[model samples]
Target: MRRPRPKRGERRIDAATDHLAQYGFAKPQIRNVIHDLLQLYGRDGWVFLEEGSYPMVLNRLLEEQAQQDQDEDGSTITDE
Candidate 1:
C-alpha cells in the first residue's frame, strides 16, 4: 500500500524527513526521532498545528534545556 500524503500542516515535518533521508535515516528512524522531539517539546508552542516548522525550534529548545541542565548541575558534558 502507498503511504498517505502529508496533510498541509505536516509539510515542515515532511521536509525534515527528506533532509534526514539525505543523511541516511530510514523512514522509521525519522518518524521515531520526530516523535521523540514532539514528546519533549510539543507543548511549548514550538510546533505549529497549521504548519510543520518545529525542527529548528525544537533544536533551539533542546540546546536551551541542555544549557539549563548543565547550569543547574554546575558542570557540562565534555566530549572525550
Candidate 2:
C-alpha cells in the first residue's frame, strides 16, 4: 500500500529529520539542529528542500566538515 502524505508542518520536520540522518546526525541532536535552522532561516529553509536544494545544503555541510577535519589534523589535502 502507498504511504499517506504528512501534514505541512510535519512534512518539514520529517524532511529535517531525514536530512540530518543523511548527514550522519543522531536523532536527538538532529531534532534540535533542525529546529534551530528552521527558526533561523524561516520557511525558505524548508522550501529550499522542496525545490531540490537539499543536496546542495548537504554537500556544503560535508565540505565544511571535511575542511574542519583537515584543520584538526594539521595536514593539507591536495585535490586531484
Candidate 3:
C-alpha cells in the first residue's frame, strides 16, 4: 500500500518546513514557529506563505534575533 496524500495545510507546513530549514531552523522549531505564525496572522499567514513571503518573514525574524543578541552583548551603542 502507498502513503496517503497530504492536505493543503499539511502541504503548506511541509513547504514551510523545507524553506525554514534552509535558514537553519530545526524541524521541531520550524513547526512551532509556523503554528504560532498561523495563530498570530490567522488566514493572512496562509496567504503569506502561499505567496512565498514566508522567507521574508523568516529573514525579518533572523534580523530581529541578531539585533536582540547584539543588544544583549552590549555591542549596540546609544548616542547621547
lDDT of 1 by residue, 1-80 (tens): 99998796476667766655664546566656566656876745334522454455345445655787899999967899
Q: Give the clash total for candidate 2.
A: 0
36-78 per-residue lDDT for model 2 (tens digits)? 5667778677675445636545554566678879999999968
Worst 10 residues of 2 by lDDT: 49-58
Candidates ranked by TM-score, best first? Answer: 3, 2, 1
Candidate 2 structure lDDT: 0.65
- Give lDDT for model 3: 0.73
**lDDT score, candidate 2, position 41:** 79
- Assess every candidate by TM-score: 0.42, 0.47, 0.57
Q: List where candidate 2 sits over 4 angstroms from the true fold.
A: 1-11, 27-42, 76-80
Give me candidate 1's TM-score against the actual structure. Answer: 0.42
Which residue runs of candidate 3 sit more than 4 Å off their true CA positions?
A: 1-10, 71-80
Note each model's CA RMSD in angstroms.
Answer: 8.9, 7.5, 5.2
lDDT of all predictions: 0.59, 0.65, 0.73
Residue pairs in clash, model 3: none
TM-score of candidate 2 to 2 decimals:
0.47
